[model samples]
Target: MAKTFKYAWLSKLSASSSALLFHYFPLRNLGYAAREFAKQGLKPGELAIISKEAVAPYERPALSKAYLFPESPARLPGFHVCVGSGGERLLPEWYNEKGIELILSTEIVKADLAAKSLTSAGGETFSYQILLIATGSTVIRLSDFGVEGADAKNIFYLREVDDADKLYEAIKAKKNGKAVVVGGGYIGLELSAVLRLNNLDVTMVYPEPWCMPRLFTSGIAAFYEGYYAKKGVNIIKGTVAVGFTANSDGEVKEVKLKDGRVLEADIVVVGVGGRPQTALFKGQVEEEKGGIKTDASFKTSVPNVYAVGDVATFPLKLYNELRRVEHVDHSRKSAEQAAKAIKAAEEGKTVEEYDYLPYFYSRSFELSWQFYGDNVGDTVLFGDSSPESSKPKFGSYWIKDGKVVGAFLESGTPEENQAIAKVARVQPPVQDVDQLASEGLSFASKI
Candidate 1:
């Protein structure tokens, strides 16, 4: 006889892709945009978000800053601990209050491009006159190096709430008090800075010789690297995590590095990168490992279906090509595009291409850095190289054929940033650094 088992699941809703619908994680900024759409009294339709993390999409920046607040000591809490229920994300009840319909806790299993419909895991089907898919990303996990106990409690990944909490608790309780961060990418550096500020002995290992090789220039990276080193964070460059050793109780005791040096640690936090969730996507949408390719209008190769967020590697007018971005702004912008397309299509209008500037922000040791667009071309920089705080705290540059690409400066100064960003975009002819600096926005005035 089969043993009795019991479980409960949330109720489900289905929608026609043609209906006015929106999709996104409940608590994320995407919720703000969706609430805007609901202002139109959109017809309730099938909307879904396949978030791999259990928590509603709360702000991720808090994961590292939570302990600093006076409210609580550093402790490892599960992903959902901070995020309010579906309420935090504006769940169906919220939609009902706003006269909008949203379907949550349901995963979309397949998209019927020909029929303009999507299927849920429970076999529920929604034919979309319009649809939006906003499931975001899963963190790229570390591979065990086959060393015994490499998978033990001392090792942790920081993708979800549980991951950050576990690492935080472990770091606080360490006897010898050592921590090793295996990557110097955006997430890794952020966590490493937090750990160092907390008075923990932290060693951050970076494969690339410089910090943020993908985002910042060598000059800026060198400055930040030195700054971090001065703050007691052992900066390890061009190295890798090779192995781990267990204590007498079988818990991981040390992290062995490729340089034959072992970092005695209470815990190891790995923050490599993140990728879109397409592992189970078997639909007929033209796709790549990066994500499903959407046209300028956010439509996929499949007719009647559109993809958004980290999953849709959509086209960019600025890049003049297709690109996949992982920024939080990209998610909001992409969702808005798909929403506009749906709203217009329901009214029988032609679709327009979605063009958006990529933006992301990070905090490192009291310094605030933000990027407006991808400035992958030649870079010209202006700033005092000295790490001392008394100097001017602004750096501006021209990227991509002298297009205003980026700027880093003290926070709470939006007007100055806007002016510099305007100059960066003008592609102003530069006779010399002094000339460009003294007379700003000669080119911008033309626009």
Candidate 2:
């Protein structure tokens, strides 16, 4: 179901509040900000987080990874916030113990930045001196593309715990049935593998030529494509699902392709992409690159207003450009940085601005891959990509201005991944492309 935002005002809280945060999702960013605010000696009941989800902040990345495991999917409290960062999990009790009010299942129906006020769907209003907006992103649906039969009962989109729960139940109910995974991105690929593991005949469909076209080169995509093929996952590229045929029960029964092909499908899952949720503050704040524009400190145009997570398009100090990162690492780090900046401002102290390097990773079956830094410049593929190899270990390096600016590795050890990050940060000069490709991991290790 889609959520519609409406603006209305009926009641208002006393204008005695000090700080407030509004996040549409139960994001780890809120938990991180709460902990940082406590560390800064902010008193209990001084800050609050208004969330649209009833659950506490939890690890979202696991929703695609361990949360889909057929045997024992990850449950609540296990993947709670801060736990994913190797810190103590912040449960509901933890928030209460810290005196931070977590107003869950509330939607901000109206936002008045000039007056520093927010009115919830219940007509309750809250005022604040400082505000943090971490609205996150919304998944793009097939309805957005005008695809037919999107209202089918068996079709799904993975975004929240509720969505995941529905998919999990469907997986159990549709065992040994056919599945069609729409899109070739991380969610599509990972979900296809998990569905296959659940004993479903999965067929991945994407309009792109290969998986992860935004980052993965053709050579790198080939490895994973072949691997999925070996696992009995049919990949249909260069075509898209134009419509769907549903049974009398309103369940999707077949997928219609553009190339005059129709495939049977017991279930359908779509993961095209996401759009940053910043419409609530469209004219209230500066906007850029499809997100709320923020400074290096994550401060927005409005005084005492800061934006973080997927909705913040802040300066990428490493790349000398403004970019909005949708990954979890940036979400957590930006929240912590913004909290620190707010604390410092109150105390008349200065904190360092955020300087983040891009990092992304995904895991499926027995394969895991990690990428670091900007993927610009000439590409150099290295290591072994052959499926026949006992251990398929391979990587790629991006050379720019005769220096290594980015890297990617599949099945890399902890230290090896760390080395690649360092190489990206330092950007060591490469004397020769052939020699650099030949050296591969050795070059990063030396860096």
Candidate 3:
């Protein structure tokens, strides 16, 4: 719950005002910067660390991939990964000597804004000159979805370490080896791919017409559905799992669909969606659609207290309410800005406003993809997929008010996305990109 700060674990030192880091890595890109602050001359006691997870800050994405394929864990970029055998271990060797307090197994229940103090699940209270609230989100379970035998042996949500562990065990133990993953969202499809990799008979069910229906256009969504089906995963669309019935052994054996057909299965993975972990901060924070509302600096209606990661939902200058991100990258970006604002205010300097482009990256099978800016809404297409044939790449830009608002470049590093981001981060340019494309000029050059 409430522990002390230690800093010898830091690979290097910054020494600014000791900071209290919340959540685990990669979001701690904030703490990485805090070390830079330390070298600039802040004291060792100026830093503190806290996390609710019992292990090192590992990537949640892996739970859906690598845990099923042992070799996948070895392929991660060092700086981009997290988690110790237990959880996010900032590592005693890294910061123990710096006097930055390390508190694990503790939960920061609420931020007492005016009092400059925080309350924790341990019932212990601590005061902070400055604080960071990096509490994240939780998976939306299918228990309330009229799913019978919801607690049956194989019904699970793929979110936390335990969830991943359960899924791995279920896949490994299924002697008949028939696995069903409910919902066709990003997490669902990715996890389905993981199960298929192990040669398991995997089937994914979604109520929509295509996979990733909420994110991509119908054409793109169809491409994905076909792509996964080709890889040996049976995708059942336009149907919902209205009711389920299991065997006497409390095992999930049959899934009944609204179409009045029953499909047999050995296990099921649920990834319908997720909601913010706002119960702890419920009445104390301003919220809409169940997420914290914050301004540029992540400042809540209450002062000196800030919220980041999945729990906070703020306006994006470029997308308006159009952007409500819950990705790992968005969390880190927002936390870094929030941390800097805290640091500047400490030195009696004017805080720099927080403004950033929203982005998300995921590997679907062998394809590596990254998206920036508004990938949805009033979309426009550019380039030709016919050049590559079987694995064609698509390029398109999102327009608003006659300006290039956001762009999506499937495949590659989304170099065009990076270019348009500079302009999209503030406001859409007045230039007419559609006209430019009509003249045979590439979107990259126009940006």
Candidate 4:
């Protein structure tokens, strides 16, 4: 069960100079960071995690995946922090035992970084000597675009547990109804599959020529589009939802497209994209690439303040550039890196700069794909990518300056995925593109 803590006791504990406050608790690595703090000699009541969420940090990605399962869906306490990454499930009791305060259901309305203080929406003020900003990102809403009937019920966007719960309830109520999923990115593909599994007629609409056009090549997208078609998913490309119509009860009923088409939708799931939640500290910190700029240690321009996860645009040592990644892997790793950096600085020591290898993956209805490294340069499609194959297995390689810069594989074994990752990192040279395509998985294996 989830636990709740009252802020009345916070007044007594806010005076410590060692106090470390986490602005939000959506990150799984927050638990790991807190543990690292305790291990580094921080005492009980010295660490506090403040979140607008009602519950402690859980696996946020599951909201669009397993949490929405029609049967045996994942729930709280079961999918808490660290569990998503095969680490310890840090339950609320664990925090209590560790003397870490979980300030749940609290929103920080004002942040005075210079004063090292945070003011909650409930008028509770908490002071901290060090701050870790993990506010993450907020989903881009249709209403933000002035779309009609954007406020209608049964229209959802998944980001937090509360959003997932609402979508799950809608899934049950609108059994066998039509679901129109907007956007063609990660959330769009995953949610569409889940909705279809729940017996809803799924139709995906995107403005791109193909799904996941940012990362997916035409050859790669063809397989998925074909597979989704076989699974009865309607793919409407090159258009977008211009507006939405609602029923008498204000539930979304129809989605009007820009290409002169209208789709009947009992439920609408919008996943266009998200913007980093950095407005709270806007102008107070250096900003770049739409995120708070930070050093290798995740330290912001201000002293004793750090930004991690989706909000931190830090140096990607691997690529020698400043970039911000919104994936869970980066979030988990960046948080831990910041914790270590903080502790090391406290001890007058230093930690190595973050060297990240970009990694991404997704799973749906027995289909899984993993990509590693940068997806730049020319591509080579390999193996049997045919959707109708009895056992479809295929991949692609991105060659930049005659060296493999990136690798993507579908339906790969654990060992195979690791091999591709190594290939991306090592970036082995290729003598010929056709030979590389023919080699496929073996090319990575030999590397």
Clashes in predicted model 3: 43
- Across residues 179-270, which tens digit of lDDT does each residue of candidate 1 receive? 88888988778878877766778899877889888877787787778778777888888888778787777667788888888888777887
Q: In candidate 2, how many Å is residue 375 off?
A: 0.9
Go through the candidates in order and give the C-alpha RMSD of each one to the true structure: 6.2, 4.3, 5.5, 3.9
Give per-residue CA lDDT, model 3, range 13-76, as digits (tens): 1111125554422334334434444444556676665655444334566667676673444222
lDDT of each: 0.58, 0.83, 0.61, 0.83
lDDT of 1: 0.58
Taking the candidates one at a time, how many backbone clashes does each contain? 17, 0, 43, 0
Q: Could you give candidate 4's per-residue lDDT for residues 300-356 as a string of tens digits?
A: 999888888888899998889999998988988887898889879988999998999
Q: Estimate each model's TM-score.
A: 0.79, 0.95, 0.82, 0.95
**Cα shift from native, residue 220, model 3 (Å):** 0.9
Score candidate 2 by lDDT. Answer: 0.83
> Which structure is stronger by TM-score: 2 or 3?
2
**Cα lDDT, model 1, residue 416:** 59
lDDT of 4 at 362: 92
- Residue runs of model 4 more than 4 Å from their true location after superposition: 1-18
Q: Where is model 4 poorest over a 10-residue stretch in terms of lDDT?
A: 7-16
